[model samples]
Target: MNTVQLERMKNDKGFIAALDQSGGSTPKALANYGIAQDAYKDEAEMFQLVHEMRTRIMKSTAFTKEKILAAILFENTMDLKVDGQYSADYLWETKGIVPILKVDKGLADLENGVQLMKPIPNLETLLARAQERHIFGTKMRSVIKEVNEAGIKAIVKQQFEIAKVIIAAGFVPIIEPEVDIHTVNKQAAEDILKKELIEQLKSLTPDQKVMFKLTIPEVDSFYEVLADHPNVVRVVALSGGYSREEANSKLSRNRKLIASFSRALTEGLNANQSDAEFDQMIGQSIQSIYEASIQP
Candidate 1:
């Protein structure tokens, strides 16, 4: 990374805080007195320790551009406080790192810059850019979904639209629908997944594919209905308000239901595999589908 980007990563407050907590010794102390006694022993051992430590630290501390971007997107908080007073001037002075007030203006500027630069072209462009930078992995996509779920649909839709424009440009109109699962009942959720959405999805294009964002509990019934329609390319199941562990546990319990849908869709897609292998692939596919559904 360039010096400017490196500076931005190093200057992140959360990252700096994490580093401070990771090492009991402050940067000042480390520069002045060398390694702490508790962290090592003897002069020779300390020398060796410092060498090993420096190598490991450099390896761990060198943050990538994508990491910085992800942190800004996911971990940034907008709560401005200037001398216990809240005001636009105070927020401006603090650079939008406040707790209570909004950062709409600052964010608008950033979004405008991103738009001008055309960072995202389409789904393919986005994926290609990520892959070219070696950060387009399944895990990173999962992180994108998590960030999208945090109610940042405008940003997410812009990215999704860009991706669609790049990959299947002019072939079909891809609709990016943002579904809210907060306090929504099963019937309401099912209604959203029904023929209404299917017709809307089909209306996008003759060959357009629909990607649905659904909570874990809504997957079985949701897909069961979708399974009847052979046009659906994917059913991306999302875990609303669930941690990664909890989502995985819930998904595991519903593996059979997912496998059934996967099996049914596989025949339509002409992708052949054994039932057992199909189950595993469906699990992995569902994870990726969910990851891809939401933008980072």
Candidate 2:
């Protein structure tokens, strides 16, 4: 396992050890402390705790909440609530729970419950659905262009509708369009942004504010065009197509730039400042950036 995973495992081990020290034999007590009992020792409790954690995670996100829940309930038999009478239950109550506890909670839930549980819209399930639907690399870029051309409002509406279905199924739907900037040169990307995206932004209504996944090259031109539009409310720039490492590097290097831009837009919206208020906001951003840069 990687360092992070190892650390998490260590933490989980610590939690389990603490629970053992607490003198509780019931599964609920172990669960409240985020401890997974060995499957052979307490199968029913292990399964139940896994179900509850999955449910909790799913409810907390915009996407993947519903589907994950459904998957857990239907595919994994997660919601069946074993009566603590079956052989599996005795095994789990005894020694069968270790494997269940060691694996990643989410993956274990999916693997164990997916087959028996009916698909539902919940946060964890929806995230799994998103992973299934994620069109990456070249395919993602093409879809972004298609979505932009079709109109962001339309795309937003469609995505929201999908999210609704995902939610209805008991999963939270995370509906972010993947943008692949790595496949195209900067000039080609700029052309797409200026020619296609600018026109789309000009057409948006004030009520349709949603976060968008877009690259930096696209941001400069798109913002420049949007600067003239009175209806556009806010913009959040995303490092689309960047790997986790690259995204992290960019975030560390330009934390101030990112924070300042976000703060300016947020303050402007909160104060109902207009495009004409750009000068004042820009001045505020300079100060915010400087302060953010100096923070330890």
Candidate 3:
């Protein structure tokens, strides 16, 4: 890795705040907050709302470098302006927060609830755009909702393929193969995921590196293998569908993992909230997740 990439890898770990809501997630979130689907009117307005929320949260005194290492942004918000400067620039210059882009198009067909990210035919273009905008890294996700062995292997292979592309493009890739919290064979699936992930890491040449973002496993130390691997700069946890309290309790069990939570991090925040209420809600969420990440 070059100096910039190496430094970004260092800055891109720990209690990351995920705001990369694609069409698949955005509508559901807007609905949950009682914002009508038509309220945004179009994609531009939707992107504006996301940027507005991020600006509000990042401007808080409580939301500082010590609490959040980076924020993963959806494609539309990557180049948006926070002040006179671009969003990434403002975050870095003002708050020491690295900006990462969400590169996955969306999910494809499902099998036993396991799904692959839809292919991006113009991934190279997107990577160039992210780099042009000074994005520090990128994240992509696939699912392991069940213990289908072939499905598990396919997800691992696909993520590694994309990960290689991201690394070659001079960006740290956050490879997320998330297992559902409600899956029946959760422990077994975690074992499979850990094994496959470790095998993939072993295949990399000495200089190759990437980060792993995974569901907090049932076993407290299930992901220690990856955490200890030289190629893995950090390991972060997703909240799945768990509430904030539940996510925090489970995430605290794993000494190696920190958070990159979405819904759990945004819980109790709503579009209707006043500025003070918005800051207070997001501040509390950041504190809770930060405490879990730094647990002894």
Task: Put down candidate 3 lDDT per residue, 1-296, tens digits, no spaces.
Answer: 23654575454444888988887788776665557778888877876776776677767777787788888888887777877778777777887888888999888889655899899789999999888888877899998888888898899999999999988998889999999888888999988888899889877888788889999989896787787888988889999999999999999888778899988888887879888888788888999999898765
Q: For every model shown, what is its TM-score relative to the native structure? A: 0.31, 0.29, 0.94
Q: Which segments of candidate 3 are over 4 A away from where they belong?
A: 1-14
Better of 2 and 3 by TM-score: 3
lDDT of each model, Cα atoms only? 0.30, 0.30, 0.83
Superposing all C-alpha atoms, what RMSD in Å does each candidate have to the true structure?
19.7, 19.9, 1.9
Model 1 lDDT tens row, 126-245: 334323332211101101122222233343444344434432532111122323344335444345335344443343444443333344554534444553444443333444445444
- Is candidate 1 or 3 superior in TM-score? 3
lDDT of 2 by residue, 130-197 (tens): 33322010000112333233343433344444434433442222233333454345445345444544
Candidate that scores best on lDDT: 3
Q: What is the lDDT of residue 230 in candidate 1?
A: 44
Model 1's number of clashes is 11
User: What is the descending TM-score order?
Assistant: 3, 1, 2
